[model samples]
Each structure stands twice: as structure tokens, then as C-alpha cells.
Target: MLVSTRLGAARQIADEAALALRPEHPEYFSAIPPPDPKALRSDVGGDLSQLFLLLALVCLFIGAVGIANTTLVSVMERTAEIELGRALGARGLHITVQFLAESTLLGLLGGLVGTSLGMVGVVVVCAVQKWTPVLATRAEFVAASSPCRNW
Candidate 1:
């Protein structure tokens, strides 16, 4: 059963509904006041945030594993070159630093490529939808600042 009331009369209508139904049909009288929808919205938002955080952690783990595997493979394939460098008086520290720099560069490049692809995908989707891409900077700032209580 659905009942529509004028604006700002939800509570009154809800109470009326409860009063009317609770007497004869006690089993069917479930009164949900106006605040319930807001509460449910917050609850769903919290659940979605937790889900996104979990997904982000999983993706970070996968990316770390991929970087480590790539670094290991590069080192393995360059074993001969590394031995040659050592024979020519390259210290262990030098080799370690070289590998570290290579891995750092690889990670940075991966991030840049991923960012570019994501931007392109967003643009493509917007174009396909014939929607103008609007940047709501104020809303973004408010949302970003809300968690810090600085908004």
C-alpha cells in the first residue's frame, strides 16, 4: 500500500498509516518514517566504500606481485651481463642500485600508462553518450574534504 502526502508531511502520514493499520492488521503494519531512507543510503554508501577499499588493496597486491615478477625475470635474463659487470669491478651495491632504479622507472611508467588509458576511456564513454564533460571542482573539493572535516 502506497500513500502520498504533501511535502513535509511524511511523518504525519506515516503515523496515520500506522494508526489505521496497526489495529486490525497488526501483522501488516510496518511503519518506516522519513529518516529510514537516509539511513539506508548512508549504510549502502559505507558498504560500497568498504568494497572499493578492498578492491583497491587487492589491485595494489596484484600490481606489486607483477612488478616483482618482472624485476626477477629481467634480473634472470641479464645474469650474464650482471656477471660481466661484477668481473669488471662493479660492486654489489652498484648492481643493487641499478636494479632498484630500473624497477622504480618501470613502476612509474606503468602508472603513467594506466592513467592515460583511464582518461581516454572516460573521454570515449562521455563522447559516446553525447554528454558534455563537466568538472564540478567545488563538489569534488567538498567531497574530498568531508572525511577530513575541513569542508
Candidate 2:
């Protein structure tokens, strides 16, 4: 369980030591084993990260499509209101801006709720583990300004 920045040099040194000791004690020499110098770091973490990244991307795509579909349906359902606004001098650009603003508002609200919940979860886990909560500057600020303690 030696941690080395240079595995090649470390393994070679261990092997040389083992070989040196082998002639005097052939019976115990078999116990000395050297790890493969060419063996790479395990890919399990990288594989898991890539898997989660792909999953998040897929979920994001689906969420975006859902948002778009819901907004489209809302606009369609409110066609009469839109037409009324137009008759009352609301320009086409105004209508477009309205929907854009609505979508942006929805996104912001989602961000706020999601972040809050995530922060609370982090705080809870930290508390349960008797560990300090580590957060980015923005989150630190949020926690500092809020009623939450022990973060």
C-alpha cells in the first residue's frame, strides 16, 4: 500500500530488493510479488463519472423537451388571450418576449428550488456524518445569510 508518484521506479526497487533476498531465502522469495509497472490507475471512477454525465445529459435533454412542450401547450391554450393582447396593441415582439420571460422565470425558480434542496441535503448528510459542510462561495454566502447553521 505504498503511494508513489513513479510506479515504475518503485516497483523496480521492490523487485531488486526481493531478488537480492531470494538466494539467501528461496522458500520466502515466492512471497515477494511485484505489481505490473504498466498497469494503469483503475477506470472505475472515470467510467462511473462518464456514465453519470451521460445520464445527466439525457435527463437534461428530456427536461428541456418537457419544458418546451409544456410552454407550447400553455401558449396554445391561451391563444385567445394572446389575440386579445394583440388587439389591445401588444406587438408580435411583445408576445414573443412574454413567453421568453415566462420560460426564464420558470428556469430561475427551478434553479432556486433545486439548489435549496441540494444544499439542505448536503447539510443533512454532513450533520449525520459529523463532518463540516463544504460549499462554494455562492453556497457559503447563501448558507451564511440563511437560518441554517452547522453548514
Best by lDDT: 1
Work out candidate 1's RMSD over C-alphas.
5.9
Please list the residue runs of candidate 1 whose C-alpha ends up more than 4 Å from where it truly belongs after superposition.
Answer: 1-8, 21-28, 33-46, 134-151
lDDT of 2 by residue, 30-72 (tens): 4334545334334654666678778767866887787788789
Q: Which ten residues in a row have the lowest lDDT in candidate 1?
A: 142-151
In angstroms, give how far residue 114 of model 1 lies from its true place. Answer: 0.2
Q: Write candidate 1's Cα lDDT for 21-65 as tens digits.
A: 677766577766666577888999898888877876787689889
* Total clashing pairs in model 2: 0
Model 1, global lDDT? 0.73
TM-score of 2: 0.61
Candidate 2 clashing pairs, residues 3+ apart or interchain: none
What is the TM-score of each predicted model, taking all chains together?
A: 0.70, 0.61
